[model samples]
Target: MKIVATPIQGVYLVETTPFQDERGSFYRAFCDRELDSLLQGETICQVNVSRTEAVGAIRGLHFQYPPHAEMKLIRCLKGRVWDVAVDLRQDSSTFLKCYQAELSADNAYMMVIPQGCAHGFQVLEAGSELLYLHTAYYEPKSEGGIRYSDPKLNISWPLKVTDVSTRDSSHPLLSEDFRGVVL
Candidate 1:
């Protein structure tokens, strides 16, 4: 695993080298020692798998506040997506800035999103599946979100958004007084 830092503090892009042969290929998706430097004492407490059936589906720009904030390592298992992370750390230099990467089975890459960052993805192909390793468990009361089309974010999604849940669509746009999350 090759971990590269992103402009946003604590965020990383992980690349996995696959060993290929006639019988397909193999690669280590996660290695505790390899990521020890980044994870510190944090251990993955939850694993999530999501399969989106339609292209142009938008999932988030979501995070948990304070005590429930999570660190997520996301990888594409099938098809492709345009993954996005927005820095929401109030004290960080890159606060409100966004980073993007193309994640797909073919790329064998993952995006490591730290606590205080809002994460979301736009499906680039039909039937896209994603695997996620999260450092914190889900807490509905701590859930928070920003609208996918929030003017303050200025996210450049690659495709026309075709689907979004009512919950996501209902997330309020960032206001002028927004101060970001304190990690």
Candidate 2:
């Protein structure tokens, strides 16, 4: 596994090398040893998977606030997606900036999203599936989000967004006075 840093402070791109032969292909999807430093003392507390059937469905721009903030490692399992992470750390230099990567089964790539950042994805292929490893469990009271079409962020989604959950669409746009989340 190779980890590369993005402009966002704690976000990263992880590349896993897959071995292929006549039998098929095999890849080390996760290695605790390889990610020890990046994870600090945090262990994955929850694992989740989602399959989106539409070609351009969007799922999020979600995060947890303060005490419940979680770090996520996301990978594509069956198809392709345009994964994105936006820095929301109030004290970080890159706050509000976003980094996107194309994650697909063939690429064996994953995106590491740290606490105080919002995560979301747009499906690039039909039936795209994603596996997520989270450092914290879901906490309804701490859940937070920013609108996918927030004018302040102007996220340049690669595909024409064809679907967005009503919950996501209802998230309020960032206001000028919004100070962002504090870790």
Candidate 3:
């Protein structure tokens, strides 16, 4: 496995080489030794799976406030998605900047999203499944989200965006005074 940094400081693109044969393939999804330094002693505390049924469905742009803030390692387990992360760390050079990649089961790539960043994805294939490893547990009171279509971020999703949950679409646009989250 190899970890490559993206434009955003804490965000990373994790690459894995899967051994393929006539019958199947196998690869290490996570190796603590290779990733421990980046994790900074934090351990994954929760694991979640999401399945999006529509080809153009959008699932988030979500994060949590400090105290419940999470670091996510996400990968497409089945099908494909246009994964995205937005840097929302206060005083960071790349605040509000976007980093995106096409994650697919075939590629075996994962996106490492640190705390203070918003995460979301657009389903590129129907029935796309994503597995997430998080360093923090979910907290309703600390939950936060920004509109996927927020003009301030202007995310260029790969598809027509055929489906979106009411909760996600309801997130307010970034305000002029929005300073950013401090991790």
* lDDT scores of the candidates, listed in order: 0.95, 0.93, 0.95
Query: What stretches of model 2 exceed 4 Å from their correct place?
Result: none
In the range 116-177, model 2's lDDT, one tens digit per residue, is 99999999999999999999999999999999888778888989999999999999999889
Determine which window of 10 residues in candidate 2 has minimal summed lDDT: 147-156
Candidate 1, 44-117: lDDT as tens digits: 99999999998999999899998999999999999999999999999899999999999999889999999999
Ordering by lDDT: 1, 3, 2
TM-score (C-alpha, index-matched) for candidate 2: 0.98
lDDT of 3 by residue, 1-183 (tens): 889989999999999989999989998988778999779999999999999999999988999999999999998999999999999999999999999999999999999999999999999998999999999999999999999999889899989989999999999899999999987
TM-score of 1: 0.98
The per-residue C-alpha lDDT of model 3 at residue 10 equals 93
Give the Å error, residue 125, model 1: 0.9
Prediction 3 TM-score vs. true: 0.99
Clashes of each: 0, 0, 0
Backbone clashes in model 3: 0
